[model samples]
Target: MTRSLHSTDRLPASARAGHWNAVIAEAYFPLDLTFRDAARFEGQLEHSNVGDISLSRLCTEAVQYERHRHHISSATEEQYLITIPRKSPVDFRQLGREVRCDPGGFILERGDEPYRFSYANANDLCVLKIAKPVLATKLRNPDRYCALVFNGREGIGSLFTTMAQQIQRHASSDPNSDAVLSRHLVELLALALDRTSEVEQGAGSSVRDAHRRRAENVILRDLSNPDLSPEIIADAVGISKRYLHELFAEVNCTVSQFVREERLKAARDLLQMPNPGQMSDIAYRFGFSDQAQFSRLFKAKFGQTPSGYRAQITAACND
Candidate 1:
């Protein structure tokens, strides 16, 4: 597999900042920048050339920036923008709520709204931009998932950080891997959106909690059966397929989808263990026909090919 590597130090001054701006615009709302000290701002930004889905990390020096309503055009599409600050602090406003994001705090932005963000001193941030249409099609209610804050230090926020780090690692190794990474990226976004909707809707019994639990148990018990599916599980639980589908509708996922996800998760865990079983053995145990199928599904679910994932785990264990 051919891979492309990009390091910030290798880019010119203008292209570094411009590249960052382009990623921001693609993932969130647009920004109209009025630099107070352009010459004073120095940074390096590196991005993979994967169209539609791009991943990049950046570090910027002291600078002032303003994002306004004028930058958002009526023709603009909706999307989700996630900002994870690695250093310094950032201040931004959304719906009249002023927020000061500390290091490691995540800032979520909506592409359909107008907002402003500013940073002082040197700062480093990791960003993930998701296409709006893609997200909307995946969620039960897309509008309700926008402009939400996720605390990076705990809970689901921590999951996002883990995913970001994983992506950065794979992306840094090979640019062609973006196609695989994008799938994991989308799954993470879906999980984030689902959790955000749950938070905003307030705490209820968690729609379909019982059904989801039952389905999860079945998945865990029968992970080695590739034939396991929503219909089979629903029948085992004495529920109709339609009812089972309705149950998962609350979380914006289907029964079969969740089953596949759980299987993939189990595979990942097994592969990460010390002296993980042989690739073919693990695949067979996890209900996959062969290593090829296992690798394909693993890449789709975790954003890295199975071999890549296994090698990473082995390297970490040796270290």
Candidate 2:
């Protein structure tokens, strides 16, 4: 279902307080609100559901909101609320930390905890609610994925920003595709959380180590090209092909093997898209020259043929 709300009119002078109270109760907090000059309050909430995820786009003219909390009826279910601000700014507090979110900034809050969010004048926000168990099953450590901020301008954050925009566009164009898009969006979120956790735990390698970082970056950049031979990549990076082999050897894999694995991962991502074509087309697009060769390699890596994997994703999306 798709829902949108936009309003520009004021409520009756006598009923202004009640009108604002009702709107807040229905959309955000189910708690009491005390306000001054309620005659100035005006807002709208645009929301939509895509499978298990609920998205709400909100905007407010002027209002002072109080701190509030809500309890979930299901004891076993955990909830995560993520807010992405699109316009103006919002001040948020969670887990003993305070954050100011502007456009392209996001904040995560746990449902079981009480928090305060204050939005200033003329603010636009997008809120996404996700179930904890759903994310726990995908992440390495679920408890660590709280109160994180993602700046949508660099690294994995940039990738996630692109994915979110794509999903939103697709949801608007083909509502029926929501189920699949939502699932992928969750996975993307999970991956982002995991990457962030790694950075926080000091698990990521030091980028200041120029040699290792540059070599890794070069391999990643050319991993999709069918002609991504180690010799060619080494030449492009001004390194000997033998050195390239030695670098990957430290990771217990050959350069060629890594390239193949990367290509297969790329192919899998493409197959998951809602494309109207044969599986062979997906294989070819990912640098596979021969369909049968691609099938053999993909099946070996994933234990399923391209067609079989596509069918499974389609069925899951429909369900």
Best by lDDT: 2
| Lowest lDDT block of 10, candidate 1 | 1-10
Runs off by more than 4 Å, candidate 1: 1-30, 49-52, 74-76, 172-177, 197-319
Candidate number with greatest TM-score: 2
Question: TM-score for model 1?
Answer: 0.50
Model 2, span 168-246: residue lDDT tens = 4444546567777777878877777666645643321232134345666776786556776776776665544544565
Model 1 lDDT per residue over 1-319, tens place: 1223333355565665665455445434457654545434455555443434555566666654445445544545555667788888887765434567888667666555556677876787777666777666667555443344556776667777777756654544454566666666666666765775455444223324655677678778998997887768876765455456766776788776777777788889888788787889888888887889888988888899978998988888789
**Which RMSD values do the candidates have, in order?**
22.2, 22.2
The lDDT, on a scale of 0 to 1, for candidate 1 is: 0.64
User: Model 2 misses residue 223 by how many Å?
Assistant: 61
- Give lDDT: candidate 1, residue 80: 60
